[model samples]
Target chain A: MAQQEFDTTAFRNALGSFTTGVTIITATAPDGTPVGLTANSFNSVSLDPPMVLWSLAKTSLSVEAFNEAKHWNVHVLSQEQQDLSNTFASRGENKFAGIDLEEGLSDAPLIPDCSARFQCRNMVTHDGGDHLIYIGEVLNFDQQDLPPLVFQQGQYAMTARKPWEGVELSSEPKAPECSYNEDLLGYLLGRSHFQMLFRMRKVFDEQAHEDSHFFALSVLNIQANLSLEEINDYIEYTGHSLTDTDIEFLISQELIEKLDDETYQLTANGRETSLLHIAQAKAIEEELIRDLGQGDVMALKLLLKRLISKTDPGLPDLWKAKETAK
Target chain B: MAQQEFDTTAFRNALGSFTTGVTIITATAPDGTPVGLTANSFNSVSLDPPMVLWSLAKTSLSVEAFNEAKHWNVHVLSQEQQDLSNTFASRGENKFAGIDLEEGLSDAPLIPDCSARFQCRNMVTHDGGDHLIYIGEVLNFDQQDLPPLVFQQGQYAMTARKPWEGVELSSEPKAPECSYNEDLLGYLLGRSHFQMLFRMRKVFDEQAHEDSHFFALSVLNIQANLSLEEINDYIEYTGHSLTDTDIEFLISQELIEKLDDETYQLTANGRETSLLHIAQAKAIEEELIRDLGQGDVMALKLLLKRLISKTDPGLPDLWKAKETAK
Candidate 1:
């Protein structure tokens, strides 16, 4: 629809549809004060003489300082720096209070642990209606392996990159009428979960442990001194249960021991076994992070957490403070 | 590190660290020919005047047309438009051949189904090193609910928006020594998988079916007339097996019938039940899509498929053409 009438809110929302990486632009005022603010308007301009540009509202409080500055540093924030973005975006004083600044080419304040940093010399300022556009010549730049933070539709985000050619699990397509296909979310989740557990099972198999025993030990690892019934409560959703025979097998292997109160705890050997399991799990995760970038892994975890919360079956919270105290 | 020597490759890679949404800027050449190219160098400049800016390399083939054009349209590409992004980014002739154009305020070719579209009157063009920056005053704009496509470090991506506060399964922190915490990818996947299944179980309960029977029907739905042993082979990874008792149960329920040579095929009733199960699964997915945006769900599925491929344990391919042929 073509609009002759300008609704500011609608215009802003329309602009927000364009996603961007979060950036914090820092500059040193003539008085030697560091001024910074969060802006997603940063964009790369030229390559030969390397240049970039960003826009700021004319009414911004730091506009004067940025205008007078000869140089500024733009920090392409990493996913871990969302708080830093919020801090600089606000009107709070001492924005750099707890920040450990790093030395840069110019006097502009350099923030550490960014996905990338660009030191630029302010080249020109153009007037655009109610904003000032600052074009800068990149003097120096460096990039890290951190996953850049993303912003779209007024929310922080992490990206899961698609391979250039895309990922396909099956070479052949399923029959059109076959409702159960590879695209089914349930099938994907089930297959992914089982495959991961399959990897963990190799480690468990070495100790002559079954999936149920491993689940039991994992529960004890989080909340110790749980009775058999309590342990089953946590592991029941997995469709695996710890039978008396399985508990006896674990005790024979010295992986677990029962107390007088009918509560079971991991023996020292059991704790070590559990730790080894965790190490294997961590190793598997590292391999996945290597295959999929850090950002994709983070996004997967975020989505999984959301899914878990939404479908929670009222099971006892494993990481709850009250549970830990008990 | 400050670089006095500019390596174009390194500079380009460093610049890529700043992620951006893909856009296709289109304008009709002086001879009434449509010219368009994909660009990521776009950013909002002013709100009061509703202005936006994008930069074009001076060496671009379309530079002459863009320079002389008095109006242009900026389309913020949606995730589904990656193919279109690649098409426009190329030097191919007739980029507008298959594209359905929408009527706009100007002669600029407006593409449909973009995350957003900005029809603008050319405002000013500024010089930035080897690039020419074209600023436009937004005469009209519109936005859609589709998720925007993201680009970072030379790859296309989809974003999973983080809530303003963040997602937490529990309010309290786990013990530092607790090896099993919420961040474990395996634990997250397993929990997410089971929790989703638990919701489906409410629907499954109505049919008086357990998960294994559901798995059996799904396998048969994909490849009909599979023997019990073959079906078990397909579903073994899920810790499910089909036994004579299970086969008899299916027969009693008229969900499946024993064919010659001891192979089993889903009866008409069985196929209908399987379709019902798929519908419920799709319903569950729709609710998830509502909670987590479409892009996030798609990304999760992509990642899960990748994970399944990586950790695949030589399970029988259910969707293999040869199997379907049988």
Candidate 2:
């Protein structure tokens, strides 16, 4: 197959679809001086040992201070702290000159009314692209319930606690198109290990001779369109107990019929029986519902139903019906 | 060296210091059914190919729909779209019961008034732990100038748009029990790419066999009090560079004194030079500021400085004038 080239601009813009928080790491120089920089590359690496990590460019001046300092601090900004994000990000001579701060554990500077704070020791450095990873072992920390500042799509933003109402009041834009088949399949497999059954049938079909008597009746019991020989091979693959006697009994009852030597098929009556297989899928669905609770399940189901309707305009009653019964 | 352990919770909480935006992924099933799911694990992979990627749990029902889907839609939440996030995250049969949506190029569901939207074709899938990575080729997308929803530390947060009118702050913590010498040494070496100078000194020292003049000078340059031959190799391992001509120049300038062929040391003037090196670092702190304009840089810097001060109660002013200037 010919390879298709990938467009990174479109891709990055696509991924920018998700938003994240912003932070600034700060440390003191040897002569008791402070240095800092803004970073969104910060992440939690461990919790038990009270560790966190952030990445800085190898050429950053603050990096030297951080590496040399006995301790450093991380500040979580509140939605009202946009000015703070700007200060540390600028090339100013005295960022803290007019900033509000208080002394905390080990005399660390703490901004009043910020969301959270973490004082830590440098852990180790890791190699990142033109950057050095700094892991900090949190020695002390604190937090408030204030809202946090967000960053997405190259812009600073804030989180909204409320849900979206029916109408588009703000006028942002439409989302990109995406197919939901894969998500549905994933849910199916998770809910009912059906993929195992599908694979089993394939394996059984491979083992059977060109024309041979197999568990044709069971295959008919599941997916009735298959030939009797195909059914037998599938039964073998799925490890279901089937014998020639059962095949004869099924034939006698008119649930199956012989098409030719080593070839057989499911009768009309057998096709009707397979509808129960779909019902079997409900057991898994019910289990998921029970685990998630009625409210959560209802939410997920509704979202999915709406999404499905977007694809096929005809599923007008998808939400109205509990099950899509055949 | 002994192996060290890290704490995951502490790390996560520390990194939660940052905030980000939220978005929902929408797609259709193989048989033309629609489905959608809430996701924050989306990020830009590349810009040139116009490709974007996100990870879906292998167990998500929407995963299956997404896999066989011809197109997918992404909806970036707005500041007022908290309800939208809740609706998308909840499990229900009629998520869009009272919602308004428009048809895009592929008839993909467009959540009206979102911060942004992107329609893309399924590009590729890669195996991830308990998830599959789906890459998309963005066909079309849109955006609006509105704040996006953000989630951090498992809570909703908004962007901090301005600096708090407050007092200046400083580092509070007293020095740790551990001596600051190692930190000082690490800081000095991190300043410049002087490793080549160290390499030249290494070659000369090996050849001279007599008290290597180059090694003696490097030790004196940084730690003037150290006797040349008595300097520890462990300290030398961290040093980056020295040159024979540089060493000779320092001695000629009375910056160092050679006690004998086997002994040498730094004079008073050399110690003052080391202090000046760290001071020059402040002007070029934001080396990692990529593809950002001056306005963005200033805003980010200001915000970062404020946040850092808020987080570290013991942080001192990183820039302090020399009190012992000659």
Candidate 3:
């Protein structure tokens, strides 16, 4: 495989294109020491015999233990176990340090909180160049609904499921040619954002507050005693600016009070109003987390933050401003 | 390993938890016919020797062809290749029917437009219980910039890469406890949406058109001669509604004209205005695609559409309205 013209880096990059789930395979050494290493080479073999297989480098410190071990446990790690996967990936002295494992069907170590687990009996070992392929027969296994952690191109990743038929915004066919279609990213983002905000508007409308008023109050709730100009600086990116009359409206409602000629602060009532709005926002997000699995929500938030970061103007960070003041 | 009490279905389900990239392993038969099968069991074996391995069931129709073959090719599939993956997955005749393959170093068929491709010489074959593992030495390989297709839990999926440091909106620490943190999905959705909208506001401000005016014109642009009430019915979900004064303003500006006592339609100038705004939105999205990568933008759109679907407040379909009227 290694020719004089072979570019090792390119070959590695080519191989990395194959995505896989991160796994931690564990086994007990002859001296009863637990050894484990992170691998993405794990794959199922046959369903009729309940078989699976994984490969380990011959140079690995745990390869001898795995070769002699009659049983080993395969932990299909959940997204929550990224740190655990990292820990086992390195050749540390005690990869399983300070960790508790569940009792498996064999002497092999069992890592808990995995997406799935397979208690496998060693069936065969074969040479795979510099690695040894271990074929196993799973005697017992269990699984959790936890989302699995993914690895691709030498980096960790997360998967968003594409439903069998595909996800469509319009129940009807797409918008006609040469017009705004449902597939437009901008339209989808705007529609989703406003639809969600519609639910929170009920809370805002409870006190006859407007969208600009909500922005001003939420900012005041986080970073207190800001001048009208400073508050607008934080929110002007939203295409909504708090006007003098908007501030006056809040004062008239006793939701906010004038700190000085130039500054305003949320009154106790205003703070409560802001918190109510925040709570409603959280409730909506909670419902989303339930509707979209936690993993999908995490992915959504991550993608949103990335989009914001890439598109961010020089808007002041409200939370950071407060921290800086303190 | 298969105990009498072992539940084969559950074991299979557990095995499916490990996500994998789809691949098509192809080899030329003894009689020179091309044979291939879709598999997710393909994985890199060793970097030093540049080895890879995949498992095939002995019962597979093409198993003998693969076993006797001396060279093979593995194609790591891109998201666009899902149909091809499904095609080779079935045991149908002429699996490569009407297919054009790229020239390769080996006699094995080479598929184009995959995320990555590896041409390899047979290194060794190992026997497991019901399956045979083929280890190959990679003689040549190549990769493309396309995003790989993922398979997990019996469904097709797309992966969103997680940055090494993770994504955060604020450089400062998160909002303190007992308050709204930046992780709330609603706030993120709102901020991202408005920030994106802010870019288009420059175009709107030039025309002195408000958000509601833009919405009304866009509706009228698509479905002609909409009454004010009918137009508001569509934009109302956006937390914005056009008032009679707003429609009168559009008419005053000659952007729209009165079709009847209660109906309004966009003037040529009004349709052009809407089209300009849509073009600006698309331009912004194209910039995002360049910045965030097309795949990330796609994932964002998918997650947003799903969020919208779940949180939709029964807004009238703008595009669907036209079709129904026809």
Best by TM-score: 1
Against the hidden true structure, what lDDT does model 1 obtain?
0.90
Candidate 2 per-residue lDDT, tens place, B229-276, comes to 244431223222344564566577665766655445666654443222
**Superposition TM-score, candidate 2 onto the true structure:** 0.34
Which digits, one per residue and each the tens of the lDDT, describe model 3 over residues A1-326?
Answer: 33737788998899888999999999999999998999999998878777899999999989889988999999999999999998999988888877897787788998888999988999888777788888888888899999899998888988887778777766677776568788877778789888888999988888887888988888888788788888998888776789889988899999999875667898888888888888888888889888988778888888888888887776787777654442
Cα miss at B175, model 2 (Å)? 34
- The candidates, ranked best first by TM-score, are 1, 3, 2
**lDDT string, candidate 2, A19-60, tens digits:** 766677777787788787777655443445565566676777
Best by the DockQ measure:
1
Q: How good is model 3 by TM-score?
A: 0.93
- Poorest lDDT segment (10 consecutive residues) of candidate 3 chain B: B317-326
Would you give the TM-score of chain B in model 3? 0.91
For candidate 3, the per-residue lDDT at A169 reads 65
Residue A85 of model 1 has an lDDT of 97
Clashing pairs in 3: none
Candidate order by DockQ, decreasing, is 1, 3, 2
For all candidates in order, state the fraction of native interface contacts they contain.
0.83, 0.17, 0.79
Residues B190-294 of candidate 3: C-alpha lDDT, one tens digit per residue? 888888888888889998988888878778877886777888888888878998899789989999999756678888888888899888988999899888777
